[model samples]
Target: MRADAGAILRIDELTVSFRTDSGEVPAVRGVSFELAAGEALALVGESGSGKSTVALAALGLLGGTARVSGSIAIGDIAVVGAGERELQRVRGKLASMVFQEPATALDPLMRVGDQIAEVIRNHDDVSAAEAQARAVELLGHVGLPEPASRVRSFPFQLSGGQRQRVVIAMAIANRPKLLIADEPTTALDVTVQAEILDLLRRLAAENDMGVLLVTHNMGVVADFADRVAVMTDGRLVEEGPVDEVLLRPQHEYTRALLSAVPRLSVAERPAAAGAAGAAGPAAPAAPARERYVEASGVSVSFGRGVRAVHALRDVSLDVAAGETVGLVGESGSGKSTIARAVLGLIEPDSGSVRVFGEELRRARGRRLRQLRAGIGVVLQDPVASLDARLSVAECIAEPLLVHARGLGRAERRRRVAEALEAVRLPAAFMDRAPRELSGGQRQRVSLARALVLSPRLLVADEPTSALDVSVQRTVLDVITELQRELGFACIFVSHDLAVVQEFAQRVVVMRAGAVVETGPTAVTLSHPETEYTRRLLAAVPVPDPVVQRGRRLAAAGGAA
Candidate 1:
């Protein structure tokens, strides 16, 4: 690829390899791209496809063990072989990075304001007070609430979306010529994801900064990127304008990727007979199906009187046998609280939780263990949930060893193998460690572990949040198939309305620790009664740029 004169960032024949104990592993193989001023170029692929490696190469952020070749130039600066001093001068001043997980990226000990100010002071010769003032202004500029008060807050005190805003504030503090955002919106909710994308677009336009977006979300690419580059196994197989690449892709891999994104239209919804009864507020009457798990008038509070936070307030929900109930809400909306309450992980201050007709809070030693055995849970982050040291077999058989005492080693191994097969993982994967598997494979192992107990109730909390679009579709299909075959009740919790609308028969919308709306998935999403629900629906970015622009314009008019 020829470098354009007007481009702010350009790469030619870039190759990167990591030195491992066995051998040198090639990650990026002669990939080339360019980003012009005020333009956005997206690198789209699954995990370990070398998209991130290329971005890291641009910033000269690769580690000592990495062997890099080819030319990477940010304007006149050479990045591939730049000295430490030269790289340091260019890093924050000429270019910046926004990482995926804000929780890990931001320092917990430092106040948000200080963190941003530190970045400013690192590159510019501004006084401490001046930098602090600029930090507060940046916070407000990024649309964070109460910039003055929030400036003193630590990362832990802020919500996921708020922390991401703070990270963006720090990244753009220097107004660099190039901005490299690596999966910046992967862990955020749909609404927050849209807001962050819009913020980046506006900031890039105002500063005429070039943006290199590394992501796996096709919808985000369609909405935000001017050009798209598709990567697979360290090679660039397809690259062109967004419409040409996404709508008329020539590569088979690109076509497969485009096919995997879940669509939210009514046509994709289940048949009317399978859908929950016509939309409206959930019927005051009880469901005829047998209730497998129930939480009534649950209330939970953290800390003392002055600092108390009401996480849940009189929230009531129930899951029937062989049914899937989706819990949808923004961060800190008490959706996870309901899951924890049903799991007996946290005791509610008021009201009761019942599982299999037995009160969870009152259940004692043996009874509690027996009750827990009947319930399975899949958390959002598979890596955190699975032990890194343990092999796949051990991870899956853990529940069996704990609950089923008489079950011998051979039986446990057989169960583990069966569970792995159930989730469409190879039996050979049992011997592999969690670290050796990909993100999608590890999540499959989590599902297998959750199912080894043959539980009657399953609670999956954002199981596909961090996965690529293709991987998410496969995982969701596996979950649906397993639920149908096993006949287990499920409480599916997620902020993605598209996935929820497809997977759940009924949907519950929560806000400020209260249930705002509940009804059939199709009805609730299509005709949201409350303004908050409408806002959330409007916030979802469709893959079609025209539709997204129209939605944004309609929302702006409504707000006006």
Candidate 2:
């Protein structure tokens, strides 16, 4: 391994395995690659591929159940057989890794400044004050809005995209030779994801570091990677330049993965209404039908007397039996508050909430349970929503078991199996724990659980926010298909206008807990009546080719 002029990191015949219940599971099978100074390489594969395992190996972060073989050289240092102490010394200086989940990776209790300062203090001989200054500088480098103010904030206070930027700042604090980003953009919206990828590229160029990007998105690979290595069942099946690999894949699995990517055609891209042809005026008012869920003069207030804070004010909306309505707004816009009120989790201070022509506030005990059971809710974070220790079957079956106790063991298993298949998971996976499944797979399982009871209404709160682009598409497709088949009313909530544009038929824009505007999705997106809506749409990052190419190079296995 050369340090000054050429290769920064070199892996020769690396093999990694884990101790599973069934026996030993070899995750990285004879993987080898060279990462040069200021280069990028992408490791791409499906959920079970060895991409993540290889990253852990590179960082010497593999746990007690894992074993490694062969040589991994980083800047003239052999990390393959290095002890814990030695690895720690090299970790921040030579190599750093940005994790998949920003929420879990960051410490919730610690202030953002302290975390970044800790990384600086550990790897470099810097005074506490100097380290703190470095932390602020790092945050600025990552494009945070206000580093000074944000430094005092906790992890929970920031958005998902903001937290990811914090993590990136920490990873690059010591200016490591190699930066391994494992699905760095998986949890972010497409627009935010693009920004993050661009930031990573600029950082890599500025620091003259190699980057190893691991992801499941073909569009990401095609757009960003300098070179791509395709993995299947822990084996490196194919390796080549990005264009050669994605546009003309030699491997069957690679081709399958490429083909699976959902692309929007020019026709599919919605045209500007007035620019093309003005949309026809709304039809003449007709006799109003009975609303399935309705809210009138809805207002919620907290505290007593002068201290009270109004969360929602004069909110009004309706969803027919088969209508899919979208609630779009920034954070703290009372979207979730309205949802809670409708679900009977909270009582509004004023106004009425009706479901099936019955008041939700008056509903109690069995009535509330029956109503809730019929209206399923899918939360943003699947891991938080589900019990990690439970098997898929148990998680899905718990609702059925509690509500419908008459069903015997066989019937329970049958229903559970049917639900699992409906979400496109194999029956064999039903026995596996949630930890074993990928983020997308776990989300599908959550959807399956929600759909098991044949609920008449579903409330999804940023359901696809924490998924890869490919996975997001799949989840959205499944939801749309099921919506058409079941004709169930739904309340789709998200900050991403692109996702909402794809899913929702009708759109409701909210701000500071008040409805800003309401109309068809096209009308709201294309001809936004309010300035807030225009700003929201304007903030969305278009898929730029230069940004994509930069991301691809940084993500690939640093093969420059």
Candidate 3:
């Protein structure tokens, strides 16, 4: 149907292609949808399915080589071929976009309140002082704590959730008619994600704003959107209300996408043979296998005295050879800090971290180097972690040269090739630059580099959080396969509870720098002992519209 007077966003037969070196490549094809005022429409798909392209095209944000066809309208503004001046007027006034990564969306140097005020000042004929006050008001409106005090703080000072709130405040500073959110809560903690979704829902209702949510997360789509549009291979495969679409998907691609979503498989785990009357089953006893590393009462603090941040508080963790321990937590939950401690990167203020029976805090010089050489680190965002100047071969070989400098060039090349093969990548990728590959490919290269040294332990930090469900599955599969052959222990740190469930045999839940719960993945997630763990599990939105609706209804009833 064509957009009527009440429609806030309308797109008809919109097709977009880019002029790549390989010639015209279609990103979006014959997509049409209408979003009414105060209604949220989610465009859901995997990577390269053109969901983001559609959102960007609505604001004419595509680059120079992008060839656009058909039409896109935000309110009465024609966005298809609009001039920069017209686009600018429409940007903050008619429509605004909240990108996925809050860090890149915000200005690191300027105070967040000033940034919000700048957007307000740009569109409205208001004084700087007035705009600043409005920014503070926006901050409070977005549920940010102590808005008045935080207004003067730079983006760096705020937490991830706070930074996202600042971005939302800026997006709605002008009260735009349409809000385009592309993967707004990709890597956020479960509770933070729920808060952001509720905030967006509340803001939309209060301001009568329509939201165009672009994401691959089925759970987010289930919780936030009124309607769902599924895209595949640059085409609209399915479109319906959230209930109808997600509850009973009509398209196979939609079904696959929903199926690909990692869900919390909570089951009725029968109590142990002799422990029927206990409060709950205890964490599994330590196995008698080869223990690779053990962290005992590990406490870490940054800064000193009153201003100090306690990143880890007497946190203890252990991993045996051929084991994968998932470290799950929110931001500032000591998960990453503990992982770094395990890697010998951080000297703990108290307690001890012993890897291969050697104390990490005391290891120095050659000892430290030797210990580090046995530990491999894989961080999130391969694009930033990888060196742009180096080819895949060099990137993978650099570790070998650093640890085993006596190895001949031929042996180094063979090791790199074997690593690539283990990760199921072609040997030809060795000569390619980091930028010359896709997100998953870059990540594979990163994995190859981490395993090139054949380290006994791997600390993978949010390694698959940024990837699509399919790509994430592939990476996890590769890791599993390699772990079987290589027999390396892994400390996988992630805020992605679903992925933690999928990849790790054991789960360690952290909160406020303390380990709240530790047990098998199923036991910890399904029957968590701590209220914090229960809250964490409850905050996770399963990829089912019916279940989500029931949860919302139950929550509303409880609130009432």
Candidate 4:
């Protein structure tokens, strides 16, 4: 195959396989693509779909238990069979990668400036002071505030979005011919994600850099990529311009992926709109729900003096039984702080968190535990929250053992099996360890663990943020089914307004430890009264390329 004259990155028949315990498993099968200079291409698919494998293969990063074949080139440098010396010369100077998690990419021991400087020094012979100065300049270029002072801070000191910007600064420090970013915005809030994507796009255009973005988010793909390539299993199913693939997908797999994305409707939709028909009358009003929990003037602060951080200040919200309330905000906006207050995990400095009609502040020891027993919690990362040593049955049963000590072993097993069935998982998975399960399966186990006690309220914190689009839909469907089957009030805490639009009846928009806006989900999100809420909503990228393009033009015109 002939390489395009303007192409900065070129690939042909790239096949990658791993030597597993079972046998040789193909990860990428005869994949071929080209990325021209100053262009953005997205590789999208579910968890194990060859997209990430292809990215790693491009950088020759797949080393352990992996075999790679076929041609991979960056500019004039060959990557497929290059030696370590040759690969090193091509890596930082010609190509650089930005990983999904910024935390894993940066070193905690060293200052962020030093990290960027180290990369610069590797490619070019420069003085340490000069490199450090360049690092600060790069940070400022990436839109980080107080770049000079922030350069001295460690990765832990910076926020998630700031750390990502630092990583991007490092990737472009050497002015590489190609920049590969893999799920760069997966963990960010919608507004922050928009900023990061805008930064990447601007950097690519300004430097004429080729960006190969690997992500499962269709919205991000539409907003950032000029072209999109859909992968399934280990093969490319569809590849075309963003509009053709997203709006008019020819492949069944591509169509399914597009359909699975949760669409956020910004139009005024009645609560009972789904029931109205020409022949049938409107659906009956929902039954009146009792106020199960009320947080009155809740204020929570950590540390003291100048070091103290006010997480929640006079923030009050309530949830009725069988209703879902969303606590939506950006990072450091006190969303999780409010959730902990409801769970009786922390004591508020002032105000009261009443759960099941009992004030959490007044509740003590056995009473607090009793109140908490009625409230179940699901965290963001299942792998981190779950114990690797415990089997699925053991993980789910652990909660039951603590909450109901008198229950017999046989009864505990019965409850565990019941919870698993509710989440649509097979009984066979009960004996398997957490590592044996996929991401969606692990999250289901997390949900099952939360349900075993038959709680009246469930608090899920960014539960589906880490999942792929298709798997995210499946998990959400299970939640909807379970919520209907077991009528429990839900306090869903998330930065993703789109997910909130789908799951919650009411939404509370929080920022800087204060409640800026609150109303019905449809009305609040569709026509936000506050500018903060409107800004948050505007930052969310729709999956449609045509619509996204129009929004981009409108935003650009406004900026101009």
> What TM-score, computed on C-alpha atoms, does each candidate reach?
0.95, 0.82, 0.94, 0.95
Write down the lDDT that model 3 would get: 0.87
Q: What TM-score does model 2 achieve against the real structure?
A: 0.82
What is the lDDT, from 0 to 100, of the residue 437 in candidate 4? 93
Candidate 4: C-alpha RMSD to true structure equals 4.1
| Tens-digit per-residue lDDT, 1-560, candidate 4 | 23335579888899999998999999999899899999999999998999999999988999978899989888877787788888898788889999999999999999999999999999999999999999999999999999999999999999999999999999999998799999999999998999999999999989999999999988899899999999999899899999899989999999999899887765112312222221223334667888788998999999999999999999999999889999998999999999998887888999988889888778888887888888888999999989999999999998888879999988998899999999999988889999999899999999999988989999999999999988888988998888898999999998777789999988999999989999888767766777687678777888987777777776687579
lDDT per residue for candidate 2 within 413-495, as digits (tens), equals 89989888888888888888888888898899999899888888888989987675667878888888888888788999887
lDDT of 1 by residue, 39-60 (tens): 9999999988999999999998
2 or 3, greater by TM-score: 3
Question: Residue 378 deviation, candidate 4, in Å?
Answer: 0.9
Model 1 C-alpha RMSD to native: 3.5
Report the error of model 1 at residue 39, Å. Answer: 0.7
Task: Point out where model 1 deviates above 4 Å.
Answer: 1-5, 266-287
List ranges where model 2 is wrong by over 4 Å.
1-5, 218-225, 238-250, 262-290, 297-314, 328-334, 388-391, 405-414, 424-441, 467-478, 495-501, 509-518, 522-560
Model 3 C-alpha lDDT per residue in residues 1-560, reported as the tens digit of each score: 12335489989999999999989999999999999999999998878889999999999999899999998888877788888888899998889999999998998989998899899989999999999999889999999999999999999898889999999999999889999999999869888998999899999999999999998888888888899999988999999999989889989988887777787654112212112233545666766778888999999999999999999999999899889999987888989999988887788999989998888877889888898998888889999989999998999998898999999989999999999998999998889999988888889889998999889999999998888887888898999999999899999998888788888989999998999889898667766777677667667777777777677666577569
Q: Judging by lDDT, tell me the better candidate of 2 and 3.
A: 3
Q: Each candidate: what lDDT?
A: 0.89, 0.80, 0.87, 0.89
Error of 4 at 307 (Å): 2.3
Instruction: Report the error of model 3 at residue 159, Å.
Output: 0.6
> What's the CA error at residue 382 for candidate 4, in Å?
1.2
Question: Model 4 clash pairs?
Answer: none
